[model samples]
Target: MSDFLSKFNGENYQEWVDEKDQKKEPKNPPQKETATTEKEVVETPKKEQAEPKNEAAKATKKDVAKKTADASQTTKSKQEQKPAVPDTAPKKNASVHPTNRAQVKQEQKTATPVTATKRASTEETEIDPTYQKKKKRKRILIGAGTALLCIILYVIYYNSVHVAMPDFTDKPVTDVTKWATKNKIELDLKQEFSTETDENVVISQEVAKNKKVKKGKTVSFTVSKGADPEEILKLPDFSKMDKGSVEKWIDENKANGMKVVLEFNDEIAKNKVIKFEIKDPNIVAAEYKRKDYATVYVSKGKEVFEKDISVPDFNGKTKAEVETWAKTNDIKMTYEEADSNEVEVDKIISQSIAANEKVAKHDEMSVTVSLGKAIVVPNFANFTPDEAASVPNLTVRVRKQFHGSVPFGGLIAQTIEPGARLTGKDETEVIVTYSEGAPFLKDYKGQVVGDLPRLFYEDYHSKGADINYTLAYVDSYETKGTVVSMSNFNEYVGMSYLVTISISKGNLDQPAGYSPKGKESLGDLEEE
Candidate 1:
């Protein structure tokens, strides 16, 4: 009886009941219990040590009785639902009463898990295979959904850290750098010579604009260093180069000490470089640098220096002609002006050297040029006609007119003003007015006949006196061309007063066949 109680308390009460029902092969399958009895059986050890053996036995019997009743009810219900298995028959000892050794023995025999496993397998076989396939498909779908959720989360994370690339071409490098710093982007900046882009500006980008770029990723771009400086930095041969080109090179290279010196070169053309000199003697012209103290000699043709030249005679030549000659001969010549009646105006009066003299080139010489004759007029107010007529270098013309307050043959006025200068270009003839005494005929007795033409005739005509003169030739003892007598003597002349002058023809024998001797008037003599 103790062994029976031991087995009953040690084994699960519900399991024992299920075992007993299975061996009986009832006509129906039992319903499964909601709660398992394994946990309660495991706690039985602890409860058996706490309770007295008799009490434990009592509790165990009660639990067995309750489980027996539950099994009987489940059998009855299952029998009504389905038919039982036909292969196995019911055993007599397969009863819920645990006091029967044979019943416990039969229950133990049927309690093997293999039989339960086989039964469960038989029941599982009745299920449709497609139901398991559906479960497998559901598992696959669940795995795919989890994987998709992970992918979605990764994409969201990637988008949050990455951004689209901006347009950087032609933008300033500073702006690009600031953008990079703000976006946590790294930049691989490179510089290149560009004619199209300005200095410090981006020329091109390795990444396309608006393309995705992860933060902290390196982006490559080219920056402009501006137009190429190699053109200006190059050093070329300066010999025989144009002056303007050399000067430009010097200015671009900033060769402060380098200068251009123009020198005479007979072989080289003007405005072309002849040679160059650098302070460093070892450094030649081909290897010159901007910092070197260099000098470039340029050609300005040759200097002018004539070895020998002949001195020219400038007499009677114009100053212009002398200047032209001096220029051609490369002779230094100086000029001075003087008034000369003999030399013409603008003509060289004299030269420093005589004609055909030997002299060196570029010698200094002087020339005197003529400004013609300078004639200063004199005041004739206090002078007589005779004195005015005797003035030098001037042709004096005398005219007599009646004056109220002057003596006969006295000077009146001159045509040219006093202190007036007349050059050789002007007319040198001057007319002087002389006073004739009051329109009167002077006595011409015993006066030379030349006096009529020299004085009295002009005096009478100048005063508008109507005085007439008659010349009679008669035998007289007087010099030739002398007036012997006059009919009117010292009278105030009227409108047509006649003055007869008897002039002596030198006393000589008359020649020719037609010789007439008479007191003939000047008119009769003229007619004859």
Candidate 2:
């Protein structure tokens, strides 16, 4: 384009261009030759060039003289026109070129508008590529930044809008449910008993508080119902059974889950001891375990009076009277005899226990008897044990006879006549009577479990011995229940004895057995 313009500036083209410049330059000053001149040049060419074409041949030679002179003269004359761009970053300053703007405008009356238009266009062409690229880059950066800002805002709004689990434990159930409804969440409620938490209050929660969750998510929780009821249970009528025995039964029956409580009851008989009592006496193996337990209520035997009491005077009471009093008051007594002229024989003369001294119920009382001044032969033909034993010079030997009842311990005969002088060395021998009190146990070992109790009384007690019985059953192959063992073997008729009876439950499978004598066969019963 520069080569084209340089070649086009021939003598004729130069003359024509100068002629036009000189004609139009008078209307505007060079200060107006700004970055805006290119636009005016484009619009004015058709209008201004018509006039120049008509006179083209006439002004041909004079253009050289005018163009050279005008250009040099005009440059120095407009020494301070408005700075073209006002600087790269333009600012409005009316004070700028205070003297130069008016002077240039006034002096440039001869410069044509065409020349300024040409120069402005040339300057812009050189700078436009770099400047336009920078403008486009600025636009691209702004567009991308706006889109990124929108994305970040969207992310923040989405996260903030999500639901989070609230602390249910802090609020009541109604408040929590209301909050959940408002936030569009589902609550999974469950109830349980707790000592630390009140009834209807939440005891624990499955989901943690303040965790962000999706809308309508379900949360699980446990609400407390306060404390539950306590349950009571009783042991299998552990009559006369020791604590260790109860413990063993509990372990074997899987009843260890229950708590054991020991209490004292006076009505129950003694075990391996002189004390036992069991009440609410239904005895069957427990079928199931309960979380709570009942009191077994084992008797420590009837409550004893541990406090002290004054001794009763027994100076003249008969043996029968003392015996009756001791049985009524639950007192124990032992009698020792010695000769004395002062107190009467066959009467409590002086108590071995002092009169009016403090005494317990079980403390022994020995009553010393007295013989009259001298021994006279007394009539002892049909005397009782008391009458015969009290004879002053007589030592009595006693024997127990089961039949020919003259009453228990009654004397059948004695050595002396009704009246005689008592001066000889002699001892008196007498026979005493006894009766049947209990049944023989060995005969009842193979009897049916249900029939043993009736047979024990009718067969054993109706004849002699006194027996206390206990019944225990187990699974066996013989029958559902059959008597298998007995505890006593003394075969005596007068003494009180304990008999532990074992029976079979007669199933194909036998329960596990624990016997110190190993397992018992029908005839291999061991005495415990």
Candidate that scores best on lDDT? 1
Per TM-score, the best of the predicted structures is: 1
| Model 2, runs deviating above 4 Å | 1-128, 163-186, 190-286, 289-528
lDDT of 1 by residue, 1-528 (tens): 665455445344445434543564556754544332222111111222223233233343345445544544454444345433222423666544545666655444333322343243212112232533555687799999999999999999988999889999889999899999999999999998765677799999999999999999999999998755533234577775889999987765556558999988879888988987777889765555445676799998866565467776678988989999889986888998888888988998888888887666667789998988798888877677778789887888877777656667767678898887887667888888887766777766656776787566575765755667888997844457767668777777654577777878778654456344433443345465
Please give, for residues 1-528, the per-residue lDDT of candidate 2 as tens digits.
443343224333433454455556555544544433223321122222422222222333334335534553454244235424222211356453665665544343324333544443422211122433454587799999999999999888877677777787835677777887898878898887555566678776777888887776787878875554332234455555666787676554444344455545555553212232232235323432333343454446555666376767888877777777767766777776655566665677777777678766665667765443445555454555456666655555433333334454544444545453332222333233333223334546666777876876665555444656788876555556666665664464434567787787776654368332333455653333
Please give the distance, in angstroms, between residue 251's alpha carbon in candidate 1 and its true position after superposition. Answer: 23
Q: Native-vs-model 2 lDDT? A: 0.53
Alpha-carbon TM-score of each model against the true structure: 0.25, 0.24
What lDDT does candidate 2 reach at residue 400? Answer: 36
